[model samples]
Target: MNRITITILVLSAAATACGTSRSATGGAREGSGTVTGIITLADEVSPKTGDFCSGLNVRVTPTGAPEDVLGNGTVRTSRSRCSYQIANLPSGGESLAFSVKLPAAWQCGNGATPTVTPEPQTLQLRDYQTETRDFRVSCTAPSAETSTATP
Candidate 1:
């Protein structure tokens, strides 16, 4: 074979090998599963009567994988905007955590992400499938009581 043709074949083989190596090293494959969740608040008042998921963020990140994943939350919606989704999550023995962020003007009663029933509200996803987890944050405000004395 010509020298040029031989070099091209070698290069192509090398490229294919590298691609396979990446996939073996946990690179995401086609049809990866998604991690979807919704953030609801536990309060005396209902979200419909008070606040919705609008302007709120539901953040999801793989546990101990890295810092956090991007594009994992929902945006403000005209109606109820509480659902959040993290697409293309590499499924394995991996688990994910969900947290909520309120707008600057608002704050949770505890001033922190409420401890959802599941604690971190994690999801164990499987390949080519979607996993769902629900998180709850309390928006209830501290109540005040008054006392009166008469003489």
Candidate 2:
């Protein structure tokens, strides 16, 4: 092998090594997609204290594989809204499920347990696609009657 040919070969190998990194789960980083959305409280419900926006948790996993979490992010207060984004997901028209959980203190406006809309949403994600799925949480002020009731 001549010196020029050997140099070219080495450069090619180096480039390949640096191309298309891998994610934490050993998945190819290329062709990854992102999921982003906002979490909102129902219009008629509100909490007196604590930052509800910052207490929301979002999780992404491959559909039917709850144990394998692709990515997760906490919602942040963005301009009077709760927003979150889970990026770097392995996308190839694969089915992925997303779910959100609100803080325990929040209760449904109907005086029941709190619940979010579109729970455990599953959808096909394509490479380089950015999907948006918003969620609305129903919550109201803590029931004073229950809290004050004596045993």
Candidate 3:
């Protein structure tokens, strides 16, 4: 065989070997997941002004790894229901925490402070899995009243 042909064959074999080695040593793979859900307000407390959903900020991060944010999304308000989705998250046997930031202007139906159910939730995600987690914001009226009269 000619020297040029021999050299080409040797380089090709080395390239193939390197590729196989990288894969065997935990190289990048397709194992991303997604998290999506809706944010809803109580029927009685639906905001009457601007879009309340727009004020919400959804975030997902590796559990115990707050500095490493995996994904983030904002709520898209449609009438009464608001939806959000965070996609393309690495999901190889990892736990993720989901949380939201409430708008400061939110107020309850009965003139009370509003609260979010399941303020922060964590779940285990697998490859190519799409997890659904819903959140609700609601509040109840204060049962006790304070008297301002003084003698």
Candidate 4:
């Protein structure tokens, strides 16, 4: 085989290996699942009642226990607007904690991400294949209450 052809083959092989590299963190795979629904307060007060909490954030953490923040991140919706709909999440056992957060208001010029850490909620999966986790935010403020509650 010509030297040019041999070099091309080696480069191609290297590129393929790099594309599918996996390290400590399980890189990537093909599995389908979903998490959708609106983020509403657990209290009887309707979200449409016009309140600061109406625009609250909904975040998901992959942890059965609320204390365990396996994977912490906020969901994306409209600009600066938060919603509860983490679509097509990775497939795994029920290991997520849902919470209603009041993230920092960027418009106010405060760079800090202000968050209202509600009681951690254990999510239940209908089916690992395709699940819908519709949860409610704990209306009872954590500060006012002493004992912690789980959802």
The top-ranked prediction according to TM-score is 3
Give candidate 4 misplaced runs (Cα > 4 Å): 1-31, 40-57, 64-82, 87-90, 106-120, 124-128, 133-151
lDDT of each: 0.57, 0.71, 0.73, 0.46
lDDT of 1 at 29: 29
Which residue pairs in candidate 1 have backbone atoms (N, alpha carbon, C) closer than 3 angstroms, thus clashing? none
TM-score of 1: 0.50
**Alpha-carbon runs more than 4 Å astray in model 3:** 1-31, 48-50, 72-74, 143-151
Backbone clash numbers for all candidates listed: 0, 0, 0, 2
The residue-by-residue lDDT of candidate 1 on 1-151, one tens digit each, is: 6999999999999999987753322455223667676656566324444455565666656667535553333444333435667666656646666566555544454545343444556666677777777666554445556668686
The residue-by-residue lDDT of candidate 4 on 1-151, one tens digit each, is 6999999999999999999865322444212445665444333323233334444555555564444333223354432233555544445655556666553321221222233344446564443454444434333323444678787
| Ten-residue region with minimum lDDT total, candidate 3 | 22-31
* Alpha carbon RMSD to native, model 3: 7.1
Candidates 1 and 4 compared: the better one by lDDT is 1
For residues 1-151, what per-residue lDDT tens digits would candidate 3 score against the true structure?
A: 6999999999999999987763221345224677888877887665745677777778877678776667434468776767888876667877777778877767776887777786777877787899988888888777788899999
Between prediction 2 and prediction 3, which has the larger lDDT? 3
Report the number of the highest-lDDT candidate. Answer: 3
TM-score per candidate, in order?
0.50, 0.66, 0.67, 0.40
